[model samples]
Each structure stands twice: as structure tokens, then as C-alpha cells.
Target: MNYRKLALTLAVLALPGVANAHVGLHTDGAMAGVSHPFSGLDHILAMVAVGFWASTLGGRARWIVPAAFVSVMALGGLMGIYGVPLPMVETGIALTVAVLGLLVAFEVKVPTAAAAVIVGICALFHGHAHGSELPEMAHAGGYVAGFMAATIVLHLIGIGLASLRFGKAGLIVGRLAGAAVALAGAVLIAG
Candidate 1:
């Protein structure tokens, strides 16, 4: 992409309208859930990073890692709905973003089970944030479905990107993207 295109894309992404789409909008159900994942940069980055890491692991991990995240996320959401408190939720979320990104950058290949566990722990923080912010009037089931669907889409995107092996250049690009994600997480932590 040319500099102009890159600048435009970044500018569009930085727009408040895109980032804060969920703010002040009162949706009765699934739409609210779907929008929530896209609303926060932290959620988007971490979820995608999970996918990227999974793809790097290859084989069964492609499915297992994401499955673990979604499954555990649901449990975390339930805990949030029931008002179970988890300390430093925001901090945890931000830290996961950084850690996940680094995992992708380094192409770390832990055992599939271990990767699932790590991803599951990260999902809890994300899922709780989603659940705790549920609108009183929204249908809980629909909202959860929507958010999970959106999250799946994000994961697919990351997997698709990671699956591309355009020689060493592609590998370098993937690493660079991971580093950028890590930097974003650090910025989130600072902010």
C-alpha cells in the first residue's frame, strides 16, 4: 500500500465514530453484542493475536486454541453476569494484549494444551468486560451470541493472515504486525 492509502486507513481507524460506535447506542440484543468487540481496540487486538498464535502452532491447534478461548470466555461472561469480581480486569486485559502479541511475534510454539490454557486465561478478562457492560434491556443470550460471532470472525481474519507464507518476506511481515500489536498493548497499559 502507498503512504497515502496507509495514512487514510489509519485515519479512518482512529476516528471516534468507529471506535466509540457502541457508546450511547441502545440496542435491545445481538447487535449490541456484535458491536462491542469492534468498539474497543484492546479486544480486537488480543482476539486477533490469539488467532495468529494459533495459526503459528498449526494442525489441531488452529481449532483448539480458539475453541478454548470462546468456551472459557462464556464462563467468564457468566461470572460477570453474576457479579463475580476479578481484580485488575482492565490491567489484565492490557497485559494479555502485550503478551499475546509477543507470542505471535516470536512464533512461540508451546504445546497445544498450554496454548489453550494461556488463551483461556486471556479470554476471561475479555469476556468479563463484555458481560459486565451488558445493557439492562438487552437479551443476554442474543448479546453473547453476537459477540462470540464477531470474535470468531476476528480470529478467522488473523488466521488467514498467518496462513500466508509469501517466503521470508511474509514471515517478517507477520512478525512486524505482532510487534505493532505489542506496542499497541503497551500504549494501552500506559494510557
Candidate 2:
């Protein structure tokens, strides 16, 4: 695969997404949805880690893991939108980051089905967070689309990076990044 093209595509896609400079500024649901994933460090780290881990697993996992996450996360989002209570969402999100990060760092191997289940579970917390945060005026459909698109973009980025074969040094760098992500998760848990 052309890593440069993938990287370039990701960079271009990211250019339009502004950070949460003024949270309520986006009156449009699509904008809000797209921007929400980028709003938090926890979300960004966890989502990227999911992609990275999936890539490390390789073969069918690269797609299946992320696909499971998005699917299950949508269910969680619906639950959140309808006022379904989920205990300790914040903690779950943080924990996923640490878990996914560790998975990447250690280059852990598990069956494809198992990886999907793990990422899918983690996605619930993330989806719920997104759903609960929906603005009253924003259309649910648009918001969901936006967030899902943003998420796919993030995953593609992680996949792209992991796909790059930099020999030993590249592998080391990626693993180090996973470690950093894990450390960040730890801090998030503490904070």
C-alpha cells in the first residue's frame, strides 16, 4: 500500500476539523459530530489505538476490529441518546485507551474474533459519550454520520502508520508511541 498517499489523505482530512475552540459554536449537527471525536484526548487516543492494534494483528483483523468498534459504538450511542444509563462511562473510555495502548505496545496477538470483541466493548463507552453529548438542536443522523466519519479517518491514520515498514526502528517508534498512549491513559485515569 502507498503509505505516503494514506498519510497525505489523513492530513488533508484532518485539516478541516478544528479543535473544540468554542464548543457551542457549531450549531450544525454534522459539524458537531465530526468535531466531537477530536474534542477529547481520551477519544483520540483510544480510537487511534484501536486502529493501530488492529493493524498489528494484520489480515482480516485490520478491518474487522475497527468495523466491530463502529457497529457496537452506534448501539451505545443510541442508548445514550435515549437516556439509557451506563455506569462509569468516563472510566471505561480511559481504561480502553490503556488497554489498547498496551496491546499495541506489546504487539499482543489474539484471535481476530477476540480482538473484535475487545475493541467492540471499548467502543461502547466512546459511543455512549458521543450520544450523551448531542446538542438538542443538532440532528441525530447528521451527528452520527459526522462522528463515524471522523472515527474512520482516525482509524485509517493509525492503520497507515502501522503499515509503514521502517524495519526495526519503525517498529520501535510505533511501540514507543503505544507506550506513550498507555501512559497518557494512566494520567487520564488519575486526573
Candidate 3:
């Protein structure tokens, strides 16, 4: 993969004001969706950690876990769009970041199926948040697609970082990143 290009793309996408300036709640649904994940530190950390954890697992998990998250998250989004009430949505999202970060930091090894299930649960909360916040005028299909694309990119970033092949040192670096994510989650919960 072209790391430079990927990094550049992510940098561009992560620009803070672009989405807000162009895609308001009543504006372009696609841009709004794309911008949503990057707008919140909580969403970014959890999505990236999901990728990092999947890579740490190192196998079929490299793909299955992320896929499961995306699929299940979309389902959760539908629930939100349809006005299904999920209590503690914010708490669930915060907990997801904390738990996923801890999983990455500790290098917890679990079966691929188990990992998928865990990530799937996290995705539900995230998707619900997305759904609930969607603008009334935004096209649902376009919005979902935009967010899903952004999400996949974040996951890919995590996978790329973990695949750096620095051996033991790389593992340490990954753990540190995970720790940072966990710390951010804690701050989110506390604040």
C-alpha cells in the first residue's frame, strides 16, 4: 500500500473545519456522514482501535473483525434512523473506546469469532449515534455510505500502523498507542 498517499489522504480528511463549513446538519448528507467520525475524538479512537486490535490478532481476524463491525454498525444505524431508542448510547460508545483500547494495549488474544462479536457490539453503539444525529434533510443512503467509507479508512490506518513489522519494538509502539486511546476514552467519560 502507498503509505505516503494514505497518510496524505487521511490528513486531508481529518481537517477540522472542512465538514463543518460545508456540511451542516441540513446540508449534504454524504459529506456530513464522512465528516462525522472525524469530528469527534471518541469516534476516531474507537474505530482506529478496532483496526489495531484486529491486526494484533494477526490472521483471518485482520479482515473479519472490521467487517463485522461495519456490518453490525450499519444495522445499529438503521435502528437509530427508525427511531428505536437505545438507552445509554453515549455511555456505550465511551465504554467501547475504553474497552477496545484496553484490549489493544494488553494484546489480549482471543478467537476471531470472539473478537468479531466484541467489535460488533461496539459498532452498534457507534452506528446508533450516527443514525440519531443524522440530519432530517440528509439522504440516508448517502449518509450511511459516507460514514462507512470514513470508518473503513480509519480501520485501515490502524491496520497499516500495526503492520509496520518492527518486531518487538513495533508491538510496544502499538501498545503505547492503545494506551493513549484508552486514556482519551477515560477523559471522555470523565468530562
Candidate 4:
């Protein structure tokens, strides 16, 4: 009845749920490619995290790194659609979560190009999984668009959040998040 109670309730309802599966996973070719990024928690987190990292790192990395992720992810999706099999796609996706999380958690900074490449590799696995799993969606086209739109929004949020404080505070939080992501990855691997 009160504002506090209402906010808490809203938060709980907003959390990830099983029904999320219905939100994405269609493959209307290019349309699906565009949308798939937003459908799942893993993809959303990973994508957004890149944007945050890019913004924090500043300069070209802000755009380059996320762009690398999306581009390579698209390639991976194509591979999946064509049945180009990659070993442990699911595990790879999990690993991506963990590794990227660590990057955020630790605030690890490497060369701009290197960071992009690393994220790109991770994106590939994530994208492939999405592409391969399209059949479950029934009508893949709209699903892709939904997912893609969601994905971009998440990225923007990450960029915005990184700017919330900037400087030392943002740096600390970014590293902490990276560590959290790593932990998440470990959990995924165990599962």
C-alpha cells in the first residue's frame, strides 16, 4: 500500500523470470540478427557491460569495443544459422559472462584493440547460441527485432550508468562489476 512496498514489489517483478524465454529467440534472418541481443539476460548483461567499459575507458574504445562485440556476434550468429558448430557454445557464453565480469570487477585495462578482440570473441559464442536457438520462437522475425532493440537499450543504459559518477568512483564500480561477472561465469560453468 505504501510507496516503499510498491517499489519493492516492482523490483521483484522486474527481476528475471522463466517467462523471459518467450521474449526472444526468433530468427527472421537479418531481422532476427538485429534483435537477438536483447532477448536473454546473459546477452544483455554482456553487451551493456561492454558499453560501460567503453565509456569508462573513454576515447575510441567507447564505440570501438561495443561495435566489435556486435559485429563479431553477428558473425557467430551466421555461423550458427548455417550449422557451423562451435564447441561448448553454452559454456563459452558462460565463460564470456565470467571473464567480462572480471574485467569490470578488476577494472582491467588493456590495449584498445585487444579489449575489442576479447569482447568480440565472447560475443561470438553468445550470438551463435541465439542464432541456433531460433527455431523455438515459432515466428522468429519479430522476436529478433525485440531482442535487438532491447540489447541496444541495455548498452545505452550501461553507457549512462558509467557516466553516473565518472572518475574514481566509476572506475571502482566498474571493476567490482567485472568481478561479479566473473563469479556469474563460474556459476554458469558449474551448471
Best by TM-score: 2
Displacement of the residue 49 alpha carbon in candidate 2, Å = 0.9
Per-residue alpha-carbon lDDT of candidate 4 for residues 7-106, written as tens digits (9 for 90 to 100): 3553343332324454553333334544456556677778778777777678878767877876776677667767898999988988888888777776
What C-alpha lDDT values do all the predictions have?
Answer: 0.84, 0.86, 0.85, 0.68
How does candidate 3 fare on TM-score? 0.86
Over 13-77, each residue of candidate 2 has an lDDT whose tens digit, in order, gives 54443654666766657777888899999999989888888999999899889889988888888
Q: What is the lDDT of residue 83 in candidate 1?
A: 89
RMSD of 1: 7.5
Query: Model 1 off-target regions past 4 Å?
Result: 1-28
Best by lDDT: 2
lDDT per residue as tens, model 3, 1-191: 76468657765654433546543453557777777888898999999999889998988898889889989988888888889999999989998998999999999999999999999999999999998888788888777877787888889888887888498888788888889888888887886
- Cα misplacement distance, residue 10 of candidate 2 (Å): 9.8
Give the runs in model 2 whose Cα sits over 4 Å from its true position: 1-28
Mind sharing the TM-score for model 4?
0.73
Measured against the true structure, the TM-scores of the candidates, in listed sequence, are: 0.85, 0.87, 0.86, 0.73
Summing lDDT over every window of 10 consecutive residues in candidate 4, give the lowest-scoring window: 10-19
Better of 1 and 2 by TM-score: 2
Rank candidates by lDDT, best first. 2, 3, 1, 4
